[model samples]
Target chain A: MVVRVSTAPFDPGAETNAFLAAGRGAGAAVTFTGVVRSSPDDPIIALTLECYPELAINQLASSIDQATSRFGLLAATVIHRYGRLTPGEPIVHVMTLAPHREAAFKGAEFLMDYLKTDAPFWKQETGPDGTHWVEAKAEDDAAKARWE
Target chain B: MKILYFAWLRERLNRGEEEVSPPSDVATVADLIDWLASRDEAFALATQKRSLIKAAVDEKLVAHTAPVAGARVVALFPPMTGG
Candidate 1:
């Protein structure tokens, strides 16, 4: 029902509370958070996300609409962060509420899967050596496509 | 036309976006790449690997031969690495 995208740091608890409150009649809420890992194989000192402002938000909204119908969820929320972020920072978060745990879980997973591969954001990793571009993985596309 | 660059493609080109009027002959995405490559050595180097670059016409992914006549936004980038 709600999609919040911003560059500022996020509060997962606040998002969870809002989703739960909005779907009080629902039986379950599932939340997923994606955080940066401290240890990258390469010398990735930090990660910076770049996105085309309008296009990024539009793509996310469209995907959310598709997911809502596929998962039959009562409510859902998606939050994505931009700008420079060090390791261990949360990059994305998704929450879904449904009449049952099964739907909630599936919906949350579906949102993340699509966001991973289909979202319009790009990641750049900076290190002492130099900055390098991250490559998109085929596995993520396949994961998202499974639901289709 | 507005050309936007993202990810490594930006670094490789050493320039984010620039307005260019492709010759009347430039029509397809691949044609644009070839024309862009002729601009300078950097552009040529950046486009050396066509498979590594992904193009979107007016914000939607397009095939290599996709026409770009009225594209408002032409984005060049490597495949997305977002999660």
Candidate 2:
């Protein structure tokens, strides 16, 4: 397992290739990437992500560990970015490998669900009007709850 | 103990982290929050919306009623929104 929280933008293609290369024996691999999307009503110019780096990493690692055990994953990777980013930029990437496709898919989904609510990252959107912190959605909490 | 704030709480409080030595009466996360809310207008205003607040004691998520007798760090923030 590999987990990274970085401020620098990453190449998703490169990251995917690296994860796939490392999982030499795994028969199935699943990847998910989250990108910043502009709101139609209130167009956002950029999004700022703030986090306690050590805490975020630790939480993500533990979540990954749970996913590995529950889904029987052979390998997993999560890369999340912090700091300011413009719309359309990638925010996170998750990849999972398992002997079969079901485990790989479920593992990737599980990691994402946990990361959405459990990670200690906060997002603020800067738009035409001004900067405002993004409110947490009830839907997100519900999404994470299903895995429990 | 070190007290950390994130997201709107940090912005509203106008700072991120601080070392606080709460009175002995502040024995739980709820108590600490009440004490903090009494410290400054910023804290008072920021903590007014209790439903939005979430906390971690010593880097582990805990309930507001959780004890904080020996905790070295406490973090307060809004619900997470990451993926």
Candidate 3:
């Protein structure tokens, strides 16, 4: 099932449980929660997420579809938050369930990795001194490349 | 012509979306970029790293040589840092 990518915070455990329950044949389930870091080298006081609403949702759904088709995931869900967010707040969450532990683990990682590098979202970080827009990290591209 | 900018490109351009009418000879994205740069100094600097900056005709990423004369929307962004 797909979760609405919204600014509202959600209970991670409940979300995880639901994903696991959906996968009746799956023996392993893994989840990842991406939170706002308290300190970043760029001096982020806060982060504001911007996206093309319809386009963002469609792209995310398409990514999930690709993962499911390629990996045979029993179930998965992705929740991403947008707009102004404070440090330590949840930015994104993903859960993957599969029959094997490896697929479960790998699938979760893949989802997050693609979401980082390919997803259509714009992030602007505001700091104590000034506000600077975020850029796609070389590290993120490298991370995504490993799975490809 | 709908032009969109993302990431640092947006910041440097100091604008997000704009409607533009390029010269009749602007047949490709490369030509359009040259025209845009000629309009302002910032465009020249920001577009200097043409290899690093990516372009998408409509929603699909395309190469610098891609035709843009008929494109309805054009997007420019730096290599993504979205994680």
Better of 2 and 3 by lDDT: 2
Which candidate tops DockQ?
A: 2
- Top candidate (TM-score): 2
- Measured with C-alpha atoms, the lDDT of residue B32 in candidate 2 is 91
Error of 1 at A56 (Å): 1.3
What residue pairs clash in candidate 1, if any at all? none
lDDT tens digits, residue span B1-83, model 2: 99999988988888989998998888898899999988888898889988788999988888899999889999999999876
**TM-score versus the correct structure, for each prediction:** 0.87, 0.95, 0.83
How far residue A54's Cα lies from its native spot in candidate 1, in Å, is: 1.8
State the displacement of the C-alpha of residue A134, model 1, in Å, after optimal TM-score superposition.
Answer: 2.4
Candidate with the larger lDDT of 1 and 3: 1
Q: What is the lDDT of residue A121 in candidate 3?
A: 71
Question: Considering DockQ, where higher is better, how would the candidates rank from best to worst?
Answer: 2, 1, 3
**Interface RMSD for each predicted structure:** 1.7, 0.9, 2.5
Residue B41, candidate 2: C-alpha displacement in angstroms: 2.9
Best by lDDT: 2
lDDT of 2 by residue, A37-137 (tens): 99788688999999878788889999999999999999999999999999889999999999999999999998998999889999988999899888888
Error of 3 at A98 (Å): 1.4
